[model samples]
Target chain A: MRVLLVDDEEELVATLAERLEMRGITACWVTNHRAALEAVDRERFDIALLDVRLPEMNGLDLKRLIEAKQPTMKFIFLTGHGSEEDFNACSAESGREYYLIKPVQIDVLTAKLHEICAEQGDRQ
Target chain B: MNGSHGKVDTLGLDYFGRMTASISHEIKNGLAIINENAGLLGDLVALTDKGRPLDPARLETIAENIRRRVQHADDIVRRLNQFAHSVSGPVTTVTLREIVESTVALAHRIAAMKGIAFTFSQDDTIKVETIPFILQNMVWICLKNIFQRHDSDTNLTLDFAFQEIETDVVIVMNFSHEIDTAATKAAISEEGKPIILFLKAQIYNDQTNRTIQLRMPKKFID
Candidate 1:
């Protein structure tokens, strides 16, 4: 699946992208919202993995902007320090299935990606 | 001092939690990178055969990356420890520059998320006896207020000048955008105002010049 990764942590994003590639997934990553936006404009990504605390904009805000641009593009938020309150707030605003805390297991992430893709395919 | 003690305590706890969360997130990101690099190295090893030699250069690069992340995490933990210790003593003698620097470090992640650059200039050696925790909280509140009002590209300059004749230190925060008086007033109201009173510090906002000035006495007595 084609995926877009957005995070300010350059090393994390780069490494994650390489691992995803190793797993036979095509992943493109960027470190800021502007670059993420530009990447979305330039390519068709099936899903965008976004870091909640971003450089130019927070992940939730960026999700909204990207959704406006590509309504069908799916999103999964990554946060390193999300409290219960933050989780509840995000869930209340955007539902529960889209958020993931950091230090996420690659296998779990891959499983979620597959699940999201399957869900999208079913919807289509 | 008009706010309730419970409210002040809650605010301090909230600030502590927020800083801790941010710092932990930073450290977690560092660890995540190291983890990913290690995983990649494992993948490389698995792909190697008994007859073929593993690329030592690639292995060295991954190890170096892990080491760098470890050092980065250490720095973050050090800053977090310093921040936590600031509240240990109710009252202490602290240099204005030191507090500003510490507060800036504590607020660095928040500012970085908004793409705001903080420039601090304090050549004068000005020390004051006060509650460092409360002072730090005051500065953090002011920064949060400013960051919330301004855009990501905004640059903030904090300049410290000591008035020897008046025996006071003035901290001027200069930004590009015009100060939102209403929002600024709200930020300084309630819990924030009480802390300012507790610190015996006076705050002034110049809308025309887009500057916020904080004046503090050389000595604070409870």
Candidate 2:
């Protein structure tokens, strides 16, 4: 599956992309909302992994922008802190299944990706 | 004034919480990078078992990256510890420049996130006796306000000068574009009056140059 990772933490995003690539998943990462939007515009990504606390705009807001451009694209939020406010915010959204906390387990993340794609397939 | 003091206390705690959260996020990001590198090493080890030749340079790069991240995390924790100890004494002799530097360090991440260039320059010889925590809170409030109002890519300069005649230190915040000086002054007065009063300081907007000036005495009296 092709995925896009967006976070201001450059090393974290780059390393996560590398790990995902090693696992046979095609992943591309960007460091901010503007670059993320540019990436989405330039390429077709099946899923977008966004950090909840981004530079200028937060992940939730960026997700809306991306969804506007790519209606069928899916999103998973990555947050460093699992505060109740963050959880509630993600849960209130339509795509709640993919909100993962930072320092996430790679295996669990992969499973979630598979589950999301499978659900998408079933809907189609 | 007691009610105002209570408001300053609440705002001080809020600033403390925000700084701690931001620093913790930085440390966490460092750890996340190290974790990924370690995982990559494990992947290489697994590949080696299948007769894939090990690249020593790649291993070295991953190890070096982990070391750099560890140092990054350590620096963040050290700064955080310094910030936590800022409240240890109620009144102490502190260099004005040092306090400004510490405050800038605390707010650096938030500024960077917004792509705002926040810079500060001071005369190292200038000293003051004051409540460091409250001083930091006041400065942080101003910074937080600026970041909230301005968009990304804005440039802000904080210039510090000592006025010998007045025996006061002045911090002038300069912005690239014209801001609502009256509104900013009002906001600072509304939210920060207690601290300003407690510190026996003055803050006003200079409409001529579109700058906000925070003036504090060289020594404060309880």
Candidate 3:
């Protein structure tokens, strides 16, 4: 499965991608909102992991852009920002069921990704 | 600003609440890191179970990473605990030096990220009958404003000098880089007024109960 991860924290994103790769999942990573948009256009990803806070465009805005481009693509929010406000905002949308806080449990994410991918395939 | 009218008690509680929010965010972030690292390690265990030969070095690194995250979480909890105690008392004789030091320590990382150097000085001789929580919150808001407006290459310096004759402690908030002077001033006034107002309310509540006594100083040393 192809996965795209975006976060401004290079170390966190890099570490996360490496963990995903270790689990036999091929992942592409981007650091900014613009790069994420460009990546979504150029690549076919099964899932996208996005950070909520970005320099210009936030994750919610980027999610809208990616969803428009790839209607079938799955989205998960991976953020270090933990507030009741953030949680509520993230849960407001459907298809965005998975809101994982950083630093994530690789096992939990691995299972979630598999579940989402299988669910997507069944729906299709 | 309302603190100028001798209402510091209510402002103290508001300040405590804001600090609790920020510090809790910090602690929550730390916990998330630790959780993620442990999950990764658990994933590695699963790989081993599948007869996949995992790198011994990676295993060792993961162990070290978890230890580091635990230490980070501990530090955050410690800071939060100290901050909590600062608000437990309604009125106390607070040392200006300790308040200045703690405020600097609390805000230094945030300021540094904004490319602003957070600096402060202490006067051992300066002691004030003040609500420490309110004072710290006011100082933090000022620091946050300075850091928010600081240019990438400039440093924000906060100097404190106590006037012995006047019996007042003076804090100087200076910026090396210029920002929207009007906006920055407005932000300071806007964010700071509620906190000061709340502190005033608490002081009034305490006065009515006669639980503690508070005195208003006669001069402003800005």
Candidate 4:
């Protein structure tokens, strides 16, 4: 599946994209909201993985903006904050099944991504 | 300082929690990068075999990346430790430049998130005796107050100028726009009264010149 990774950490997002490509999944990454929007406008990405605590605009708000642009695109949030209050805030914005904490295991992340694709397949 | 005991308690707890959270978030971001880089190294080992040799250059690059992130995280932790020790004693003698620099270092991350930059004008630096924690908290609060009043401009900047007036040291926080007088007054008078009293400091809102001049005495006595 084609994926878009949005995170301010350049090395983290770039390395994740490289690894995803090695696993035969197409992934493109950007470091900010404006760049993320530009990438989406340029290409069709099935999934967008966003870091929740972005600099200018938080990832949840960016999710809304992207959803307006690409209604069919799905999202998965990545956050470094592990507090219950932070979790609740993010889950309240997106459903509970939609976020992964930082230092996330790649197997779990890819599993979730495939699960999302399968869910879409089921919907169709 | 009669009813201020409770205000101090509330403000201390509140500021302590927020500052810890912001700094910890920064540390976490650094850790996340290290995690991904290390995981990539393991991935490389798994993909290596007899026919296909592993690239030493790529491995070296990844190793270097991890080292850089470790140093980055170490620096953040050092800053956190510095902040924690700010309240180790009741009060201490410190330079005005040192106070501004330390507080700015702690706050620069939070400010950058909203695109705020602090410019310092240190013409003449003087020494003062004050509670380090309270003084830093006061400066941080004044920053928040300015942000609340003047964040309409997308490109926001706060300028800090230090001046000496006889026996007093005044650190003026200049703004990019003419701040709201009523809002600034209400915020300053109500929000940081405990801190103002604690540090024996006064916050004067110079709205005409778009500045908040924080005047503190050279000798602080409890």
Candidate 5:
């Protein structure tokens, strides 16, 4: 599956992209609002992994703009500042499958990515 | 800006919570990076089990990343510790530059949320005897007021410069919120008057230049 990873922490997202590539996922990463928007504008991504907090704009706001451009793209949020309780509350609205906290287990992330894509019947 | 013991107490708790939350968010980011670094190492190890040779340079890079991230987290904790200890005494001796830097560091995430940048510098450092926590809170309140007042079309950086005025320190803050000096000064006065009275800091507004200068004595006598 092709994925777009957006987070201000460059090394974290870059390494994640590398790992995803190793797992046969075509993933690209960006560090801020502008670049992430630009990437989605220029390239097609099946799913997006976004950090909830960004320096300049809310990641959810960025997600809306991206969704406008790529209406069918899937999403998973990764947050550092939020607690599991916060995630649970957000999950009630967004879904339990939609959020992951920092220090993610690779197995869990990979499985979630597959699950989300499989639900779309577009497993890659 | 209400001068009441209960109000100040509430404000202190609120400021403390904000600072703690900001510091923890920063530490969590550092931890997140370190997590990715460690996970990359695990990925490398898994490759080795499959008969793929490990690239020594890549291992070193991961190791270095972890090291650097650890130091980053440590520095964040250190600053938080210092900030926490700032309230250990009602009054203490501290360098004006150091306290201002600490205040700015703590306010960074708050500013980033507003897309506001800060530029601070001082050619000379002056030591002062004052209430560190209260002084920091006052400066932070003023900065927050500036952030709230900033309604310009573009993202703006607040410029702050410190000058020694004999026995006092003057922090000159410059920004481009508006050219209406009277209105800006009135807004600041409405919001920050109580803290200004408490700290005995005089504030000057220069509308033409778009600046607010806060001047306070170096020594606190209580």
Candidate 6:
């Protein structure tokens, strides 16, 4: 599956992108919301791994922008704060299963991707 | 002498607090990245011990990233230490380019948070004997103003140039986009006018000699 990863943390994004690519997933990484938006406009991605606290625009706003364009694009938000308010807001907007906290285990992230892909298939 | 002066002091304190907070956050984030990279290397070592070969390229990248972050952290700490000492005295011989670059680095997240592309374009060769902390405060105010007017997708660029006009160095911060009067008013009034007054006084002192012009375009966003 193809994935777009957006996070301001360059190191984290690189590691996560590498791990995903190692597992046979095509991951394109962008450091900010604007670039992510621009990336999506140019290419197609089956899913996006977004960091909640981004540079230009936060992940929540970027999620809305991305979802508006690709309604079927799967999302998994990665956040460092994991505040109750932020979690609750994401849950309300995109369901609780899509949000993951920092230091995310590679297995857990891959599992979530697999689950998202399975759900998408079922929906289709 | 009055509550106004108290508010002015408070505004200075607030600006200092914001700068320190952002500096600390950047340091912490840098350390966090280093920690994660180290952890990944540890994980790789364990995998290798289990007879699974890891990519040498991954190891190299991790080490390189850690080295770069360590250097970044050290630079920040050095700047912070110098800044603290500069706050000790009123005026000092300060490198304008260093202060500008450090300020932009410190304000990167804040500018990015507001969708403002904070930039520095200045001559490193220029050095000035000035009130270090007060000058930083002025730059901070200008940055805050630029961030206030930033749009969602806009990129705000700051250019710092030192011109040798006769016997003086004119430090100019060229910015894009029209200034919002209400935001400027609120920024000055809600906090305190002492900063602006301080800047004006400093400029006025050198008005016949040196000049500092902070210019902004009527409307532009990159």
The TM-score measured for candidate 6 stands at 0.68
Give each candidate's fraction of reference contacts reproduced.
0.82, 0.74, 0.32, 0.74, 0.74, 0.29
Q: Is candidate 2 or 3 superior in TM-score?
A: 2
> What's the best-to-worst order under TM-score?
2, 4, 1, 5, 3, 6
Tens-place lDDT digits, model 6, residues A58-115: 7888999999888889888877666686799788877999998776777788899989
Off by over 4 Å in 4: B1-4, B50-52, B150-153, B176-182
How well is each residue in B108-202 modelled by candidate 6, as lDDT tens digits? Answer: 77876775664556467766565666656666775676576557565655566665454344556555554454455355333435755544422
Clashing pairs in 4: none
Best TM-score among the predictions, by candidate number: 2
Please state the Cα-based DockQ of model 2 relative to the true two-chain complex. 0.76
Candidate 2 lDDT at A97 equals 78
The sequence of per-residue lDDT tens digits that candidate 1 reaches over residues B86-131 is 7655678878777777888888888877756666555547777778
Candidate 3 on B130-193: residue-level lDDT in tens? 6667667776766666556656444445454333335434444434344554565556656677
> What does DockQ give for each predicted structure?
0.75, 0.76, 0.34, 0.67, 0.60, 0.30
lDDT by residue (tens digit), candidate 4, B106-168: 877778777788887756457788877778878778777766665633767778888778888
Docking quality of model 6: it rates as: acceptable
Task: List TM-scores for all candidates, in order.
Answer: 0.89, 0.94, 0.69, 0.92, 0.88, 0.68
A1-124: candidate 2 lDDT, tens digit per residue? 9999999988788988988897889999999898999998999998999899998789999999999999998889889888888888887764567788878888898898888888888999
Scanning candidate 3 chain A in windows of ten residues, the lowest lDDT window is A93-102
Error of 6 at B133 (Å): 2.6
The positional error of residue B194 in candidate 4, measured at the CA in angstroms, is: 1.2
- Tens digit per residue, CA lDDT, model 2, B1-222: 246478778888898999999898887788778888898889889888889988999999999999999998898999999889876556888876677778888888888887666555545777788889988888887877767676565555545444433678776777667667767877887778878888888887987788887888878877
lDDT accuracy of residue B27 in candidate 4: 86
Measured by DockQ, the strongest candidate is 2
After the best TM-score superposition of candidate 3, give how far the Cα of residue A120 lies from its true spot, in angstroms: 5.1
- Considering summed lDDT, which 10 consecutive residues are worst modelled in model 1 chain B? B156-165
- Clashing pairs for model 2 are none
